[model samples]
Target: MFAVGFGANHFIPLLQVYREGMASSEASLTAMVGVYAAGLIPALLYFGRLSDQIGRKSVLMPGLWVALVGTLILALGAFSQEWPLYLGRIIIGVSVGMGMACGAAWIKQLSTDDPVAGPRRATVAVSAGFGLGPLISGVIAEFAPAPDFLPYVIHAAVTLCALWWLRAAPETQEGRGVGKRKIVPPVVFTAAYLLAIVAWAPWTFGAPTTAFVTNPSQIGIDSAFPTLVQGLLAFLTMFSSLFIQPVVAKLLANGPRWLALAALGLTTTAAGLGVAVAAALTGSVWLMLITAPVLGTAYGIFMVAGLAETERFADDGELGALVGIFYSLTYLGFFVPFLISMLVTGAENVFGMDPTQAYVGVLAVGVVVCLASIWPVSKAAGYGGRS
Candidate 1:
């Protein structure tokens, strides 16, 4: 899970390199980030079912090889090639989607001795990968020789070990082929689940992503080491996510219901967006940095809450599929940057707002959207309570 996740987000900080090295357009750059979903959603939808049919080892081992292949593609792409980067990102997404389902499932199986710890550890492992990958790669990209290529080399090296490690891990699932059970779980379409899909899921990645990638350039940050700065923002957000999970666990220990956790997480994400608004308006890079952990806390809360909800709602047969759904929705947030870029350009042409002013409006709208979600989300929680 950690290695796959490292491959997943390691490409993010390199966007700056692509932009500067390849002279990529903003639209194309943002597409690279959003394009991850293209490969991820399909894998997410079925890898769960695939893992359920085949053993976890069968799905996971191949996924690691795919991850290394993706990283190598990225390294090659660094030689001023644009299409390779995009292709690499798509491939990385597929591998990540596989790991998200099967790796997590395998971890859960291994931790059968301690039921509650499995999900927590899985979350931590991937999230830590997400944070550190960018941090290390960003630094290396900033100062090391072959900035673009070296980071991928490091990641590929680490991922190679994962292949061996997972080889020794026991297989959890049998190749049951197709049972009478359905692939798409019923709970996913329920009103309670729909609330997460609509309201909570998008912002799961949206908030933290907006913090690091989207706003940094728009807010007039002219750092000497752009990659490092981006990496720090990502690092801060993810590490904060890791630290806050324990707090969330304690808060939920009393069983205050997932609704409160969802509401608070979304609302806090809104507040972070609100801060982002201030940061952009004032052109304060430091203020922008402050928003990273705030948004990340909300991200952490949502992750814990989302996984807990999956456990609550899914049967053993449907767990992987449900996990896939949860993550698929969150990956949608990757498109937030692309959407923001498009909207800002459109606003400049149609609404007659400058890019900076237009971006501020978009962020402000995000704040409102998050705040508004509280009611519907709570209603969903109410449904859960009633049932």
Candidate 2:
């Protein structure tokens, strides 16, 4: 529920910004979508550890409230000037950053006995909520009379409802004999290999694809398609986690971490290359439809692998802090490209290429980065046997 609210609020207003007044050429559209992620990175960096010290519920409730306020700001932003969009995005980013770290940790704690089930459920909840948000928002925006106001109004209501539901949910972390600890932020490593996978796989396969689907020349594609595609990709990617996770958990669950890591790296690299090929050759909407699932599955594998690796490295006491660090890096992978796009408005200038093609170029870079990272990641994970 928190995930849904966060995801919905993140993208809907950005879409509206494009719809209302922003020129497609300005890359404001991409920046608007990207800024939420920008906010997420910092929150994950600084505040993610807070959940560890306090409690999951303590962090989560306040985060949701912040999200609600952000949504309200977004709603009001639609009426006021353009700057509200940035403000709302920043606020929503903070909410999501805080929510994602705490929420995932909370779910993990609830299902603690079963490691596979716990993480699987946590991943699904986050992914599904993210997917659903755009689907609902897109439908409402496309069909509803007052597109902008209604979608956000509905989002705010849903957020409140989630907040109410959470009031009854149990806290995963109990107040401990543990004394008040200093708020120590986790150190962030680039996780070059992991980051490569993220840049190539999730960014290329997941993020830019949304923009591709929105390209005008792409047959049967539009802004709505991007939103819908993003939703679908999120759902499928997370859903794969539900099934494959258990199998992986059993095989290398704790047995051979390097093998599991390598497999993920290879699969993600392949998927990125596949999408790049599909984009280059067919340029068909049907190809994109097919690529979506392939890429999404790859994304799921990468996410699970990354999280598992984080768990493998973390001490039990510092799990929450590590999770926060991991997520902050992940969000960084998610947003930096959109900021780059905003800087390079060349998408508007290209004659033969559509906005989607520009997106493809961005994705291709990610793919290349991923491919290059495999050897380094293998080294980092101590997969000398495989290498």
Candidate 3:
């Protein structure tokens, strides 16, 4: 699961390198990521259900195999610098979709010792992978030869180790029988889910696109710096999730407060991103780094909070279905950048703004969207209830 995240996100900062190194169009750059989400969304829905019947390891090992292949393809793409990049991303997306859906469920089932232990470990593994992937890629891309090629090679090696671990791991779902299940959205998951989804949108989907759209290269920063900055964006967002989970757990120990905290997380992400955008507009790497802790904390808080809320609404029969649905919705954030890239292009042509300015405009709009939700989210969280 951790390797899945590592491979999935490691390519984020490399978008800049691909753009400049190969002279790829901005549209193609964003499309690369968009197509990934396109592949992942469907795979999540399909595979999560499939795992129930076939057992966890059946789904998990294959997913890791596919991920290993996908990583190799990505490395080849970096070497060849052509359609392979697109193909690699789509393949990786599919692999991650399977890995995340099945791997998380597997972790939960195996954690019979403690209920909370499963989620905590799974979240940390994934979050740490998400944060470190880009940072690892960026460091290699910055300092090493064949920057693009080398990073994927390292990831491929890591994927092999994951495969080995999965093979040795025990199968937790033994007595369960395979049955067909439909992914109907739960009734209890209404406005609250929507609010959480909205709150999560900015970071899960918005951050990477915003970072690349406001490309530091446009403002005369070295090519490597943009890569580092983009990596930092991911590093902070995910790492914060890892670091802050325990704190969030302690803070929201009672009631349905996680939903409210999720809302607050989104609100903070919006505000912090606004400052980060301003920093981007000025080509100030320092300012961008400053915003990392805030973004990371928000992601950590909102993600766990939202998950806690979702767990409450799930019935045992359809717990996996609900988890699948929740994740599928959140993963929609992956495509947000692609759509924003298109909008940024339009804004450049129609509004006469540079990429940085257009990104700032988009981010400012995001802030408004997040701000508007606070009241409703608070209300849903029973803000005025017995304190």
Candidate 4:
């Protein structure tokens, strides 16, 4: 799971590399990120359900190999073209989507005796992978020989080892899977369940997308390393949850489940407002610095709460399918930066505002949506006993 995830977003920090090398426009560069969700959504829908029927390892092995192929494609075409990067991003998404759905179910079953620890362990693995992928990719690109190609080669090597390691883990689902599992979980049809996803999932990635993708570009600074600022922001936002989630988990253990989710909604609302402020203000680089951590904090809380809640909603046969559905919704936020760019261009042509000037209203709408999500999101988690 970790290795697959590491390869998934390692390309984020290399935005400058692709932008300059291929002479890609900002819209196209951002599209590379958004297109990942395009591939991920389908994989989540299909491969995750396939895991339930065939066993986790069966699906996982092939997915990991596909990830290596994705990296190789990236390495081979690093500076030579533009379309391959988009293709690589899509393939990486497919592999990571498989890891998220199947690996989470696998880990949870491995820790079957303790339900609480199961989701925690999965989130830890995922969050760590998400954080470290960009951090290492950026550093290696900054100093390593063959900057255009070396990073992908290193990631492919790590993934190869992960594939070898994966063979040793015993199959948990071979003989144990429930017969006649549905491709889609029934729980997802419930209004409360849909509300949870609607209110929490999209914004889970939205916060970080804004933090690392949009924030860095909005606040310019003089730096020798092209990827350093965005890479650090990615690391900081992801790793912040690694520390904060355990505390939030402990809090949930001691208090009501709804509190964690309520906090998620509140923190996400705060993050949106902060994003709007940063977007609207001039020379708000420090504000971007501060907002990134808050975004990370929101992401962490949602991970713990969302996973636990999804686990709670699942029956014996439905775990992987439910997890798949949950994750597919989360990646929708990756399109945010792309949308922001499109809106900025459109607003400039129609309203006669520059890109930065158009950001204010676009981000303000985001803040409004975030603010309105609070109650419904909290209510989905049984706020006031309403679930």
Candidate 5:
């Protein structure tokens, strides 16, 4: 599970480096980031059901092997042309899709009847892995011998260890019948459940995901230190997830869950405004640092709470299917960056605003979405209290 996330993220700090190395356009670099979803979404949709039918180990082992291959492909790209990089991202995405679906379920099965413990453990592992991957990669790339080549080499070694460790883990799905499991969106959910999902939804499309990779230059950061900056941002995000989630979970347990989400949404909106202001004020990078706390806390709470709410509403028969759908929807945020980039470019041309303003302008749309979610949040709170 950890390897799944680590492999997916280890390349982010290298995006700018790759761009300069390959003389690639921003559009192509953006495509490489967005292309991850291209493979991940479909693999998640299929493997979620497939894992239920076969077994966790059956899905996980193969996924690990595929991810190893993807890591190698990415390493090869440091010496080759651009295509291998994008292709590597896609293959890594596919492996993540499978690992998330099967690995979470497997963890749940091993949790000895503690529902909360299972998903919580899996979420933390993934979040930590995702956070640490870029941090490790960036440090190595910045100080180590083979900037592009060595990071992947280290990850390749980690991947092998994870693959070997899986051999002794027990399989959960023994003798389960294979049946047709289609991803049908839930037509009905209690108001609280709906709010929990909606409140967290914007985290996917919001700034935290994009700023580190795309907007670093707008904050007056130099090209030579992008790896350090990216690594710092990744750590902020990961640390926030690790530290804030339990606090938010405790708050939700004590009070209205919907209110917690509402607060998170407002924090995110404030962070977006901060980004705009930082850019306007001569790109004050320190002020711009607000993106991490707001986005990270919101993402952490939303994900953990949203999964809990979804599980509350889901039927036992379709647990795997529901989780798959939930993940797919969450990941849909990956597309938001590409779509917003297009709009930002257009707005820049039409209104003559700078990249920072354009970035914030798009974020305004997300703010509206966050505010509009308050109604559902209210409903979710009411429902959670009663049931």
Candidate 6:
């Protein structure tokens, strides 16, 4: 929850800055918001497996402290210049990478020996965190007096409380108890890793859409409406994860990877179509609002399916490293679209398209990617039917 909240609070503010502060030509402002993912990939590569050797708590606690500092840096930077935002975001990327790698493992360790429950709990925690983070931040930023300072201050407090809660949580791993494990070099490419990468595009593209549609200038939508839509989207995504994850796990328990991949493809394609249609009918925020939940559900399904594939293919000893790789790729998707929007803004002098058109284009591309990949992903996962 803390990790999710941290991301939500910090991530949206950066987007708000891009929309409000910097000129459209300065795509760097938007790009900077996601550049942290670049730093995260390296950190995940280098330190991902260390948690498996040491204990989850040992790594997670320190990560939280770093995140707290990052929040402070971000808050301070908001008052100063944009460089602090970049620096703070990088720190946050590292912190979140560490937390995801270790935190998921910790949740799994704490679950009763049910293999089903372990992954389900991890899924729930992640979804809940992601949902809560942005929802709370959006609400606070929309409604609260000190939009910039208050959000991070609240986040810092939340992180402190999470740190306290973590102290009581039991450690998941005992180090090899011998000398430390040698650090493994980064694995840049693998078939499964590549699949995870392709699977992440729609998810990341969906993120900025939430912010864009909600922006008052771009869409002329109500300030509170976007936040409300985002909260509903978050809830649908999280709620689906809570229920659908275990079900997907059960179906794929013996490795129905192809079927799961196909489901992901279909659902994502449908969601994308919905977004495109919504864009065509831009006058109706009501219609666009309806699609938000569907998109969220599709995202949830894709996440569960992707994680299962990662888990199925990863070597037991390299679980943390493999998961970290998966996460890095996932966040890579997060960075690319923002970068694209920034670059486009620079070349074109402005994002001339209204919020609706921008999102429709994004969702259309996402749908096409998922549809095109379906056959390949299914073949790779070795599923027999569309089922």
| Candidate closest to the true structure, highest TM-score | 1
Q: Candidate 5: TM-score?
A: 0.89
Q: Residue 269 of model 4: what lDDT?
A: 48
TM-score of 4: 0.93
**Of 2 and 4, the candidate ranking higher by TM-score:** 4
lDDT accuracy of residue 360 in candidate 4: 72
lDDT of 6 by residue, 21-72 (tens): 5442235554565677766777665556777667677777888888888888
- Show where candidate 4 strays beyond 4 Å: 257-266, 272-276, 382-387
lDDT tens per residue, model 1, 250-290: 76556556446788789889999989989888888788789
**Candidate 2 local lDDT, residue 350:** 61
Per-residue error (Å), model 2, residue 11:
2.0
Give per-residue CA lDDT, model 2, range 1-387, as digits (tens): 345433533354235435444444335555665677777777765565677767888887888888888887877655646677778888888888778777777776787577655545655566556545656665665556665566677777777888888989898676742344433423223454344333333442233233233321233343444444444433443343345555555654565644645456455546744664565455564565555455545545555555565555554455566666666655554454455454224654764556556556655665666576566555555221112
Q: Could you say which candidate leads in lDDT? A: 1
Better of 3 and 5 by TM-score: 5
List ranges where model 2 is wrong by over 4 Å: 1-17, 20-26, 177-258, 262-266, 280-282, 336-362, 382-387
- Note the clash tally of each candidate: 1, 1, 2, 0, 1, 1
CA lDDT of 284 in candidate 3? Answer: 73
Better model by lDDT: candidate 1 vs candidate 5: 1
Tell me how candidate 3 scores on lDDT: 0.69
Q: What's the distance in Å from true for residue 159, model 4?
A: 0.5
Residue 27 displacement (Å), model 4: 0.5
- Model 2, poorest ten-residue lDDT window? 211-220
Q: What overall lDDT, based on C-alpha atoms, would model 5 receive against the true structure?
A: 0.69
lDDT of each residue in 1-387, candidate 5, tens digit only: 888878877787777567557776666766787788888888887887788778889998999999988998988887847878888889999999889888877887788866566656777778787788888888887778878799999889989999999999999886786576566435324445455565455464354565555555334455457676677666666556767666755654565544654446545645654554555356555654566655666667666655565556555445555566667767777765567678878989999998877777776666676677656564554243234
- TM-score-wise, the better of 2 and 5 is 5
lDDT of candidate 6?
A: 0.57
lDDT of 4 by residue, 1-387 (tens): 788768876787888666557677788888888898888888987777877777999888888998988888877666578778888888888888878889988898898677677767887788887888888888887777776788888899889899999989988889765667667876777787877664668877877787778766544433667576667777877777788767776765676655646446456647655664664476455566567777877877776777777777877677788888878888888998888788877998999987677777777777777777777777677321122
Estimate the TM-score for candidate 2: 0.79
lDDT of 5 at 300: 70
Instruction: Flag the better candidate by TM-score, 2 or 6.
Output: 6
Over 4 Å off in model 1, which ranges?
175-181, 196-198, 382-387
